[model samples]
Target: MSQANPDRPDLDLSSCDKEPIRFPGSIQPHGFLLALSPTLQVLQASDNLDDMIGADAARAIGQSLQAVIGEQAGLQLVPEIDAADIGQRPLYLCTLGIGPARHFDVLAHYYDALLILEFESVARASAADFRHLHRQVGDFLLKLTDTASTRTMSALAAQEIRRVTGFGRVMVYQFDDEGHGHVLAECRADDYPSYLGQRFPASDIPRQARELYMLNRIRLIQDADYTPARLVPALNPVTGKPNDLSFAALRSVSPIHLQYMRNMGTLASMSVSLMVKGKLWGLISCHHATPCTVAFDKRTACEQLGQILSMCIESREDANELQFRLDVRRIMVSMLAGLTQSADFIDNLSSVFPALLKFARAGGAAILFEERLLTYGDTPDEEAIRELVAWLDLHCHGDVFHTDQLAALYPPAAALAANSAGLLAMPVSRIHKHYLLWFRPEVVRTVEWAGNPHDKDGAPPAAQLTPRTSFATWRETITGTSAPWHGGEIELAIEFRSALLGIALERAEQMAELAEELGRANKELEAFSYSVSHDLRAPLRHIVGFSDLLLEPSANENLEKRQRFLRNIKDSARLAGKLVDDLLSFSQMGRAALRPTLIQMDDLVRSCIDKLALDIGARQVEWDIGTLPAMRADPTFVQLALYNLLSNAVKFTSQKERAVITIRASDEGAEWVMSIADNGAGFHMDYVHKLFGVFQRLHRMEDFQGTGIGLANVRRIIERHGGRVWAKGAPGNGATFYFSIPKELNI
Candidate 1:
C-alpha cells in the first residue's frame, strides 16, 4: 500500500484520481520506483522496497544503487540510467531476479532533476517470444493495409489486437464533436459482455488524461486489484515534488479509475491512442477478464497499427471529399444555367432553392432579397425568419456564416432550435444584403453513458473527481443540436457561394449593358420626335394655306367643286397634325423621369374629371366613385393616366342618354389596382387588343373622333411606374380598363 504524505493528508483518493495522475508520487504494488541523483546514489525509493528487492526503503536512500540491488544487477541498469535524457523516452534494462514472484523488467529515465528507474514483474514467459510475435504482427499489418475504409480497418485492427493481446474483448472507439466516444468496431470472446454500441462520456477520461494519451500512445493497467506503492520520500528529493511519470510504463493507475474497472469486472486494461495528423482521434481499447500484461514490444506493435489505421482514415476521407466537390460543382452548373435563363433573377431562385436543400441535405432554406423573403421546405414563420435574418446581419462578418449549434451561439435562436439548430448562410450580394440560408433541424438523441453523469445526492462545491462506481447503462436525451457539418460540407458551401457570386456578377454586367442600350434608344427617339414636329408640320400647313387661297371667291371657277376641294384640304391637314402631336406625346412619355410621392387616388381621379368637364359640357353623365387607396407614384403620370381613361369613357358613351362611369381601387398584396367602367359604343373583344396601339382607331371618324393614342399613352405611363394595364370590351357593351401599380418602387 502507498504511504500518504503528512503535508497532503487532505488529498483524498476521489479528488486525487480526478486531477492529473501523470505526476503521482506512487507506483503500483507490482512495481518499484526509485529516484537517484546524477551520481547514481539512491535519493528516494518506493516504501515497499523490501518487498520488491529485499532492501529496506529508508536504508536504501543516500546509498549507491549498486549497494541496494547488488553489483551485477546494478551494472545492468547503470548504462541505461547514465544514457537517459530528460524528456526523452525511458530506456529498457534487462530483466532481473530468478522466479516468477521475483523476476522484474527494469526501465530508467532522467526527468525533473533526478534519475528515475521503475521495475515491474515479468508476467508470462511468452512475452519474450518476439520471433513469433513479430511474424503475427507483420501478417496483421498486411491485412490492415489491404483495407481502405476506416470502418473496415478498425474491424480488422480490433480482431487482431484481441488475438495478439489475449484480451477477452477489444473495441475500436471513435470520438464525436463533444469528446464522447462510441464503439465503432469490437471483437470479443463468447463469455465476455459486448460494449459494441455503448457510448462513454467526456468525463470518463478527464482533460489531463487525454493530454497524456497524446504524449504517450500506449498505457497498460496490469491488475486493477493490486495495491499501490508509495515513493520513500513521497516526493522527488531533488525537485521536492512528485516525479513526472508521464512516460513511465509502471505508473500507478488512479484509484477511482481502478474502482471503475473493478465495477466493470475488468481485471486488466490496455489502450493505444489512434492519432491522425497529430491529433488524438480515438483509441483501441483491450480489456481482459483476468490479470494480463502486454509485453513492451507487443504494445509498440499495436501503436504502429493505430498509426497505420489513422493514415487509412485520412486517405479515405480525402477521396470522399474530392467526389463530393465534383458533385457540388455539377449541381452548381445546373442551378446557374436556370438562373441565367430566367427573366428575373430573384424570382428564379424559388425553383433553385429546392435544389439547394437537396444538395446540402438540409431540412429547410430561405432567401432574403431586400424586404422580400421566400422560403422552401420546412421553415419557421415569416416573422421569425425575418428576426433571424436581422440577427445574422448584425453578427455575420465574412461572406459565409455557419454553425452546427446555432442555439449555443445565439441565445434568441434557442427557442428556434427545434427547427433551425444548424444554419449555413451566404450573403450573395453585399450591397443589397441578400442572403441564402440553409437550415438543419435539431437532433434529439439518446446518449448511452456508462453511468448517471450528474451527482444525484446533492451539489458539491469541489469538483467531483471520482469516477462513478456503476456500470449500469444510463440514457440521456440530448437536445438543441444537430449533426455537425463536416469539413467537406463547409468547403462545398464556400465553393457554391463563389460560383453563385460569379453568376450574379455576370447578370449585373448584362443588366448594365441593357440599361446603356435603353438610354441610347431614348436619346434617338427624342431627336426623331424633334425633327418630326418641325419638318412634318410645314407641309400640312402649306397645303391648308394654298387650299384656302384657292377657295377665295375670285379664284373659284365652280362653286360645288371649290367647296369640296377646300373641305378635303382642311380634313387632310387636321388628320396629319393630330398624328404628329400624338407621336410627340408618346416620345415624351418614354423620356420623362418619374418623381414619386404619396397621393390620394380619390383626389387624383376627381382632379382628372374636373379637367375633362369642358368636353362633358351638356352631356348627362352619372358617376359612381368608391373609396380609393392612397398610393406612392408620380402624381403627374397618374393624373394623365386617369384623364386618358376617363376621357375615353366619356367619348365612347356620347350616344347614351345617361352615361354611367364607375371608378374604384382595390389592394392586391404588393400593388394597388384601379379600374374605370363605362356604358358606351365599345369595340368588339377581337379588336380590344388593337385599341391600345397608336393610331389604331376602331370606330369611324363620323361616329367618334379620336387619335387612338390615348389608351397607348395610358399603357406607357402605368408601365413606367412598374405597373400593368389590361382592358376587356365587346361591341355595344361597356368596357372596363384596369391598371395596377406597385405599392413601392425604387424611383
Candidate 2:
C-alpha cells in the first residue's frame, strides 16, 4: 500500500496542516507527474518517468517539453497548456507517450505559473469500446425516469454502476438530517457480506472529506496496494507548500482512508457524490476485492449517472412532501371547523389531539389554555410539562418553536429525555398565554461502527495518525435523543399554529366584548327592573280589578259586563306571558353555545320559510329566493335567526296584495353578506339605530303582533359568530335586513 514515509511508524493526525496524507506531494506509482514552464520547458518530472515513458528525470528537467514527450505529442498539448490558468479546471489531453506502445490517459492543469501534466496507463480495450459504454449509460438514464421512489432508484443505480465499472460491490449511501449516513441500497457479489441497513457515523466521512467530495465529484483509487510516486520537488517552488491537489483528478488517497479500506480487505474503491439543491446529499460508493482501474470515459459516465440520481432523489422527496402537505391541509380544515363550532377552543383541540400529534409524528401532545394544562398520548407528568412550557416561553422565539434534541438545548429537558427528547411547541395566544406542545420520545438505539474505534491499549499518542485496524462491528447504545424533525414537519407545525392563531384572535375579541358588557352591568340591571314593572303592572292590575268586580253581588247578575271584564283580563295576562317569553329567548341567544358547520344557506332559508307557513296562510306571498352560498356557522343559531327574519317579513307585508319576500346571499370579499328583504310596513330611516335593540319596535302591537325582540335575537346570534347586522328602510317603503358572516370560521 502507498505510504507517506516508509520509515514513519503508523500515521499521525495531531496537526490540522502538516497531515502527511493530506499534503502528500505525491501520486500513486501507476501515474507520472510533470511540470512545465509557460514557455514549454520542463521544470520538474517524477523519478519514475524513465520506467514508464523512457525519459530520464534529470535529463527531462530543463528540456523542452516537446523533446521529452516527442514533437507531435508536445505540440498537441501546447494549446491546452496555454488555455489553462491558476484554479482552472483540468483539461483532458490526448493519450501519447515516448518509446512505449502503451496507452496513457493524459490530463493537464495550470497552477502557480506552471502547467502540470499527469499520465496514467489505461486499457486500449476501454478506449475502443466507447459505443458499448455509451449504450450501457444510456440504458441506465432511460430507466431512471421510470423509478417510483428514491430507494428503488438508488438500488437500480448501484446495480448499473457496478456493471459499468466492474466493481465487486456497489452501495448507495444516504445521509440523514444529522449528517450520519446509512447504506440505503447495495449490489454486490453473492459471497460479499451485506452492508445494507448498516449505519455509518458522521466521523467516517469527516467534514474535510465531505468538502472535498463537493469540489471533486468523483474520486478513485486504482490500486490500494500500489506505492505512492513522490513529486520531483516535495513542494511547489513558487508557493513553498504542497500543491493544492483539491481539484486534481489523480490526487493521492488519504493515508487514513487507505488504511481503513485495507482493514476492510478492499484493494480498490471509487466514490461519486450525489448532490441535491447544490448540497452534497450522499455518495455512490464502489469497492473491489482486487486492484482495478476504470477508464476516464467510464468514470465520466458514472458522474453523469450520479447527477441524474441526485435529481431523481430530489424530485421524489418533493413529491412525497407535497402529498403529505395535502393530507395535512385536509386534517386542518376539519380541525378548524371543530374549533369554530366549539364553545371552548381548547376543548375542541383536545378532542382532536390525536390528529394534531400526527402532524409532527410526535409520541405525545399537550395543550395549555387559560392556565390549565391538558395532555394526551405518552407525555411527561403535568408538572414537568409546565416547566417545559415555562422554559419555552422564555427561550423560544416567534409563535412556533421546535427542536429535535431538546435535552441538548434545555438542560431541564434532560431529566425527561426519555419522554420529551424532541419538542414542537406553538403559542396559540400571546396575551392569554395559551400554548400547544408536541413531544417525541427518546429513540434509544445501538449503532454499529465499522471497527473498534478505541485505542488498542486504552491509550494512544496524541499525534498518531494510524487509523483503527479492526473491521469488527463496534456497538454503541445512544440515548437522550430522538429521531430528528424534518424541514417538512417544521413547516406543517408553523401552518398549524397560524390556523390556531385565528381562533385565538376570535376568542380574544369575545373576551373583550364580555369585558365591555361587564362595565355596563349596573345600567343594564336598572333598565331590566324598569321594563319588568312597566310591561307587567297593567296585566296584574286588570286581573285584580276584574276579580273584585265579580265579587260584587249586583255585578254577579250583570252577565255581559262580567263576560267583557273576564275576556279583557285574559287578553292582558296572555300578552304579559308572551313578553316574558320573548325576553328569555333573547337572553338565551347570547348564552347558547355555537356548533358551526358548513351550512347550505339555501336549505336553511327554505327550512325557515316552511316554518312560517302558518302565519302566511291564504296570502299571495311571492318568495324570491336567489342563489345562496354555503357558510361555516352554527346551524341551529342560523336557523333561528332566519326564522325571525322571514316571520317579520311576512307579518309586515300583510298590507300588500303580493308580498314579495326575497332572501339572497352575495360574496363580500372576506365575508358573505346575506339580505332578507320585504315589501312590508317599512319603518323610517331615523329609527334605524334602534332597529335591533331589545323591545325596540317599528310598529304598534295592533299593526304587527310581536314582542319586538326578534331583531334583537338575530343581531346577537350573528355577532357571536364574528359577524355584523344592519338594516336599510324608509317609511312605507320596503325593508332589507343584511347580515354578514366571515368566509373562514374564526369562532
Candidate 3:
C-alpha cells in the first residue's frame, strides 16, 4: 500500500484562488488542478501520487490524466462537473470503475503551451489519525456504561474527539424539545477562548441544515474559500429547476461558509452526526485553527467511532426504559397486594415511576394478551392494546416480535410509523402469550446501562464514514461500522422478563391457595367458639353450682372453714368464665366481616378517652390532642385499638407526679402515621419484644391492671387493616407508640 508522508504539512486548501482555467495550454499547476476533464497530460507527479496508481512518479509525468484515471473515470466526471448549485443535485461525486474505484479531482491550466493536469485522490485522507480517533471513540463508548446521564455521555464524546483530533474546540450540540439546539458539552483548548454554554441562534443552523445533517451524517469543509464552480443547468426536461447542485454536487467552496469559519478563527471544521435509528439525535462538532486535512484512514476510524457512540447512546436509553418499567412494576405490585383495583394500580404507577426516574414525558404503557389488553398510564390514541394483542396472537410462536412485523394487520393510520422510534413492543413471553408496550413522546437522555461483558470480535473494517462530502461513498466499502448488541444482553433482558412473569404467576396461585385455606380455617374456628360458648360453659356453670352447694350449710359449720371453701369455688368459676370470654373475643375478631368506613382517628381517640374521663379527672394529667387523618377502617376495631393504647399509656403514667400524653398524626405519602406518646414510667427496653405478644406484659398485674392482652389487641387490630404498630422508649424516658395505615384502605 502507498502512504503519504506523515511530516508533510496538511494541504492548505483554504487559499486555493479561483481562476478561469485555459485547459488546452501550458504547464500551469493550479489550472491543471481546476480542469474538470480527466484527459490531460501530467506535467509533474509526486511519488505518493505515482505509487497510488501503482506506477513511478517519473514515468507517470507527462502522461495524459485519462491514461492514469482511465476512460471510465473520464465518463463519470461529466455529471459531477455539470451539477447546478441547487438542493436537488447529487452532491455525491460518482466513482467509475477505472483500474480500481479510485476517485480524484482534475484541474488544469495552460501556460507556455504545454497542457498539464493535477490530480488529488478523494480517498487520500489521514488514515492513521482516523484509526486513533476510532480507538478513542471506542474508549468513550465503553465509558458510557459508567453513567446514565446525557450530560456525562455528551461531555465524554466531545472531550475524546477533541483529544484525538487535536481540535481547538469540541462541543456536543443537542436539540431541545422545540428543535432549538444548545451546547450540552464543550471541551476547549487551553489557549483558545471558551464557547461553552454559548447559545447560537437557531437560524444559524436552520431546519434545512438539520435535514442535511441527517442525510449527510458527517461533514468536513477543509477550507471554505475555494473557487465556486458555475452552476450547470439540467439537460433533461424536468418539472422544476435543477436541484441546487450546491447541496448535491461539490463546489470549490462557499465564500460565505469560509468567512464564517474564519470569523470563528477556525481554519478547519469537522462534524460527526450522532444518530439513533436513522434520525439525527445530536452532533459532535470539532474545530481546529490550522488548516488540517484528516487522512482517509483516520476518517474511516472516526466514522466507526461515531457508530459506536450511537450504540452507546441507544443502550443507555434502553436501560433507562428498563429501570422505569421496573420501578412501575414494583409500585404496582405493592398496590395490587392490597387488592387495590387494576385501575388504581395504573394511576399509582404513573405518579411514581416517572417522578423517580425523571423520564421527561411518557405517554402510556400496557400488557397485552390474546383475550384482553391491560392498558395503563398514558395510552396512545392510535394503536390500542387490543390491536397489539391481536397482532401478537396471530404472529407469536415462541419468540419476541416487534410491531413492525405486523404492519399488514394494522390499518394505514393505526400502523405505527417507522419514524416514531418511540413506539416499542417487546414480548413478555416467547410463547406469544403476552407483550409489553410503552410510548414515550420525547428523546430519552442517555442512561447508564450495563453492557455485555462478553468478549467481542476484534477484526476491524477497512473504510468508514467521515465528515467530508467526497468520502460519502466510502461507507458502502466498510464491512461492519459498529459492533452489534451482544447476545448476552438481549438474553439477560429476556430472562429478567421471564422471571418477573413467573413470580407474578406463582404469587397469584399462592394467593388463591391461601384464600381457600383461610376460608376453611375461619369456619372451623367459628364452630369451635360456638361449642365453647354453649356446651363448655354449661358444664362450668354446673360445677360452680355444685361447689356452692358444698359450702351451703354456713350456720351449722365452723365459719372460717366455710368461707375458705366458698372462696375456692368462686375463684375457679371466675377463671373458667374469663377463659371462655377470651376465646370468644379472639374468634370474633377473625370471623366478623370487616366493616370499613371513613372514621376520623382523632374522633375515635377522643371517644376512647371519654370512657376514661373519671380516671383522667382524678389525676393531675396534661393531655395534648393532635389532628388525625381519616382512614377507612372498622370503627369498632379502631375504637378497641385506641382504647387499648390509651389505657396502657394512662396506666403507666399514673405513677408519675404529673402525667403528660401527646397524640400526634401525620401523612407519609403512601400511609398515615399516628403516634401516641406519654411522659410516664417507661418499661425496660429489654421487654419491648414481648410488648405486642398475646398474654405478655412488661409490668406486674398490680402495677398496670390485669389482662396482659392490651397491646397485643392493638397490634391485631392495626394489622387487620394492613398497618404496623411499634413502640419506642428508654427506661423512664417515656414511650411513644406509632402506627401506620395504608392510604388505599379508603377505597
Better by lDDT, candidate 3 or 2: 2
Tens-place lDDT digits, model 1, residues 148-253: 5777788999988887788999999988777888888999999987777778877788778889999888889989887777778877777777777788887776
Ranking by lDDT: 2, 1, 3
Candidate 1 global TM-score: 0.64
* Top candidate when judged by TM-score against the true structure: 2
- Candidate 2 residue lDDT tens string, 1-747: 233454234445554234544455677777788887777778777777877878787788789988988787777666656665545456666666445476677777776556778787775613323456568767987887643778889999999999889999999998876687878899999877778877776666777788878878998998887677666666676677766676567777677678778878888999999998789899999999889988777887888889889988887775576567668767767777777777687788888887877767889999987788999988999889888888876666464788778988898899888779988888764323568888999999887755544443243555334555565667778898888887657665665665565455456446645764655534544655665566668677887888788668876566557557656765765566556545655655655568888989999898777767767899999999999998999887888888888888999999998899988889989999999999888989988998887777778878788777789889989999999999998778889999999988777
The local distance difference test score of each candidate is 0.76, 0.76, 0.52
lDDT (C-alpha) at residue 654 in model 3: 85
Instruction: Name the top lDDT candidate.
Output: 2
Screening candidate 2 with a backbone cut-off below 3 angstroms (N, C-alpha, C), the clashing residue pairs are 11-465, 11-466, 12-464, 12-465
Candidate 3 is scored at a TM of 0.33
Ranking by TM-score: 2, 1, 3
Task: Give the Å error, residue 344, model 1.
Answer: 3.1
